[model samples]
Target: MHLDVIIGVSKNNKSGACDVNDIEKLGSDPKVVELFKLKKDEVIFDDDSDIFITSGSTGKPKYAVHTHFSVINGVKGMFYYLEGMPNKENRRIILGLNTAHISGEGSGVLSPLVASMTSVFAPPVYNIKQIVQTIQNERCTDVLFLITYLYDMLNFKDIGEYDVTSLDICLTGGSNIPPKLAKDFEEKFACKILIAYASTEMMVPSISSPWDPLEARCSGVRILPNAEIQLVDDDGKCVPLGSNGEIWCRCCSNFQRYMGNDEQTKAAKSPHGWFKTGDLGVFNAAGVLSIVGRKKDMIDRGGIKIFPADIENVLSQHPSIEQVQVIGVPDERLSEEICICLRTKKNAIIEKDQIVSHLTGKVRLEESVPGYVLIFDSFPKSITGKIDRMSLTKQAIDRIQSKVQ
Candidate 1:
């Protein structure tokens, strides 16, 4: 079937989620049909151990095999600190797109269940109206959602009219959250929002709580008791505090092995058993972790990984186009939104909406392109005159987000 369905299949494979045509499509590629397989070094977790697949975020997607023990550890480590939060089980609304992502079933579902909390499962649609309506209808209290959804929900023009005071805790960070959006949510809700940062390696990076101050709003939160994270440079040595470094975690909650790929296993895990998260983060003076960016050149649409270089090359050839740079920004649905910044140097200038229309119909980027584009007179360059992609990407995301308000 579709690549995204495999996750649904792996979780709730009922209803013949993949039809025959889906099978035919998958059967064409050996890599496609065969995604998860057992490894020689590891057996499935049974009465003795827990086993699961890894969230492949680094170089390639790999399946890490882990056990129930790790799952419990993931949940406990995240919720253990929330004993103090007023148990809002009285009546809470959970806008649940976060669960549909990699962490959807696990962190968003299981961990909350462990806490004896009830939640509502929402779809991946970007309908802010529908989301707000759901909150009003359900009178949901807690929102286990990413930055995109939470940001949009807060901006809903009639939000104050909805009696949404029942909502208390706002969570984010399956991907990036715009600081501006974070600030708006803080003011609108008057409720503290805490960001939870973790990966397929594990879901509870920060102890689940209400909002933190602006400076503490950054995600990929500090290490929990059951986990240990280190920011390391290329040589595998720990980097000093405040320096950019690849985040590595050796945790009791982590997966045990890459399902079938030996090379993936070796590349993902350290000699000492730490799993490299591929995300880059810096520690605060108080030991909280703030994720600055990712090591892999990939974009997160909501929580889905999109490679911009793959899409931009395809978009550049449009008869209306000239040059382009694609990057992701905070999206309410996918943690990140794919945005293209470019110059239309063609004989006929292409309208922004036209470019979106063309790509939606003509290019491989129909689903991957950012919701829109950012055209500029020029792009900032590095000291070496290289286009500063990271800076450009942040700018593009910021520009788009500013318009959302």
Candidate 2:
């Protein structure tokens, strides 16, 4: 694929630029020439243009095709969002994500390029210290980070020493964003966190506006322009407004198809073009969309459905807990049991009973209380920097089995 060649070219060229001489030195390839020509001629790519490979966080990797119509319109949506922020002309952003994924490609690379803004790249391996230093050094105006990054920054005690006053607006998503975390980060860093709802297939469907109330920051996001969203039940029927259902989105920027995966594409997309996001969401009366959890990640214990985000949200409020990942493990009587893998804050001691006590009244249901609380120094992460729940589930199971043995 052309993107494959571009990935290789990006790696060899640390400067994030390439010329005819550089291409010649790397050995002339027709695909490389085609890529440069596409850039030079400024021609729009057709709908069949295979652009990016999904991070495979959900399952197997799939290639996504993006027409220039989608990209330009998607960037236009970003410009609309930026209209709410201050300093329209001089915007500097910190990029600390893997560019391979759509989040990184869109927010870190494409958004900056299209806006003609300065982007300060963080280290390949995310380091809160380095990120803070870069922001202080560069006087960065904006930063978009994953939820985990927020937790890390909050845990970093020395952040008070940094002068990040230049930060006007920041953003985070990729999973259920804990409201407590968002509030705490803003209190400490003095920057508002706008939650966004997006996917690799759907370029950016929604984002919380800059003027949203502080309490509403991580609660939900307002749908962006040129996007239509419908919440549907398992039966594929649309749910009532303000009810929870899978998020189906239709936008000009939505991917045309999953390259070479017609079966998957058909499964995700409707005949009319709405893509099932596999994420559960509810709409508030004001039309803000709140993502509750992943539909597939629901834990079925004795036929009682448990959404991990519900439990994780309560757990994250604990002063000692820095990060938490909830998963379901096989159980003889329960069918599947809730297991919470947690990374504690520095020098914080937590016991299983303490955690159980903490969740007893906080969780939506009694069964939502975790059957297993495994404390870890760190949770395994996917390439896109989100929690690697697949690997984490295996690790949790193995640890449980070893104890039984």
Candidate 3:
């Protein structure tokens, strides 16, 4: 909410900072600006003020509340884990979109000031060539990647072009990435791509850094310090370490309440301090947590649980594939079977066998991959640009049901 009337001009160094007055000219109300200032000041000082990260987009944006103490706690955990990992002291160069979404705000923007001297600048618009050019020109050595953008970058070249030799790591998150994309990125760039899993509610909860063993990487990862992670069965009882259960996290960094919605705040939070993440997962042998998939999205195949991410990861590695999402479809034999909706750069006519054949080398066919492959022009994406799989699945179901009738 920026106002455009600076009568006097006396400045030390002309910084390109945008204050509230500047925002006012762009459509935000002046009152919103004033309220933000007041709230920020009060929260910055108040011991109980909640620190929140807005979801990258909204079906109703939940302001994840975290206190100053919580932010410090979460940050400490991140740094501690980084310290324990191999060669953790490298200075990082950051590229992020400025949307005030937690990933962009907390990881990309704030990390430089709070964590280290981050490479803070506007990023290329998911254009690989432009991104590579910037990286080469700036000599910024690392990146925190969004899956949608990372997939785009991988399609640009075979991985040898543009001083990629300097890149040490790329951290990707927000949602599941096709495993093939992960493998190709590693092979092409010769750097490990760590999978990151977090939400608006928790900024940086689960990270699989390059230093971890491969098995640890597939799981959601252990809860960071000061963060409480547990898996409970549908009955609300705590499950064993290796069991697949609904994931929950409780910590100081939790959001205060949804901005204007009280009911959602209540449902998302428990009286005992935990918040249901809505994700389902399990801890692997070494205590590393693996996100099986969304609890609501789990496909029941004749009673066997089918997590599409497991299969999507497998299919994504095919040479003909670009990106893919797996969803459950209703079937008489199994109640629910698997259907893969994919977008590819390899071929116009997709063959399900090719996907099955490609994935058989990586995993057993019976364990996870779908029986069918459905190709589409593109996906309906969320505000964060992640695929809106829920919508896609709904449409797929409608089309199939119509045929059945």
Candidate 4:
């Protein structure tokens, strides 16, 4: 029940066997106690429990706790949905994700371990050329990519040079995939791209299956069996079907809590146990779920609310654009003005005027247009390889302040 007892009996403890007394002594030692006590609730899971560290894309990283039953349920759900897809016999899977995160833990470690499948891990730094070579050499049949990695691979200059004909199922998660990028990858690679929707809190709740229609496959995900999804407004009232609202999920695989943050755990969970995902989503008439954007990521442009994903999706279609992140910058008049930070393709030249004109033709709302466009060689990335909007917002603020001075 206590922390020391939990640590002493943890299966992951590789420091030889020890009892509760020894662990307590170690915890009491001045040199190591501070580290152990940094988080009040940082207790180890049971000996047989499966633990995964979150990517900390939003803030500080935390541990997500799962039991054997939960992990098995998640893996079973994946197999159940992927059962009828082609290349089911081909178990060679390429896991190009960071194992520390749930995306990697579930697909790379747990799923393969339970199913006895071969998982080809990319190098620590994940060189695109090396990954491409591995797929060709291993003849990997299934590959899971984080959105950033997917974009990088799709934009890789020598992508056509590699023999990637072996790929059957391509899955992407951690962030939304541009519809154009998904469609392009499928057309070029001759494989189905499944855009999965899941969180560290609830592992693999829904994923776009190959059974879905082509347009639905590219747009949203079908909720897996045994998982429940509810979309609720700011007042916690359930939204009508086909309307946008915050996504709340509850399922067998949902994590118990934020490892050491009681306040966060309380705030994220409702009385009925539905964990508030903080991301906005909408369900179609057919009940498939499509993510809109994060509630916290929405920008207040004067009185109107703007979702950055909308602008980012539009700009991502520009021929010269390689990657784009839309953020909000402080504005005296409008409260928050839209600022887009973009990375252009190699040897591509794009001007602010060109982007403005492009948006003018594509974006219907005048207010949705980005107030400022800044081109960057590369965007700041979090530990999980997501674009660090917080960092970019700070840089944008600094740039704006300097100009006023």
lDDT of 2 at 296: 80
* lDDT agreement of model 4 with the native: 0.79
Model 4 Cα lDDT, one tens digit per residue, 1-405: 134423344345556546656766786689787765685465443223666777666777777777766676777667665555555556788988887677787767777665666788877677888988899999998888877877777778898888999888888887777777777788888878887888878888998867776678767888989699999999999999988999999887777776667888889889888989999999989898989888888899888888887777778888999888888898999998988888898899988778787777566575446788787888787787877777878888888788789
Give the clashing pairs for model 4: none
Writing each residue's lDDT as its tens digit, candidate 3 over 165-238 gives 77767777778766556666777776667777777776567677566654456445666666778889987789
Write down the worst ten-residue block by lDDT for model 1.
50-59
lDDT of 1 by residue, 1-405 (tens): 115553232434667476545566765777764553434246543323433433332333445555767777777875575444576356354655534344566656766676677767654544667666777688777776654466347546777667667677776565555444566576787656777777765556455334455645544365678878889998999999888788888887777665556877788788998888877778868787876666765676655556554466456566555456676666666676667787665355767667666567544554534577678766764322235666776687677768878
Best by TM-score: 2
Ordered by TM-score, highest first, the candidates read 2, 4, 3, 1
Q: All models: lDDT?
A: 0.63, 0.82, 0.67, 0.79
Q: What would the TM-scores of all predictions be?
A: 0.61, 0.89, 0.79, 0.85
Of the two candidates 1 and 2, the one with more favorable lDDT, higher being better, is 2
Q: Give the worst 10-residue stretch by lDDT in candidate 4.
A: 1-10
Candidate 1 positional error at 256, Å: 2.1
Best by the lDDT measure: 2
- Assess candidate 1 and give its TM-score to the true structure: 0.61
Which is superior by TM-score, 1 or 2?
2
| Runs in model 2 lying further than 4 Å from the true structure | 1-45, 48-50, 157-161
Question: What is the model-wide C-alpha lDDT for candidate 1?
Answer: 0.63
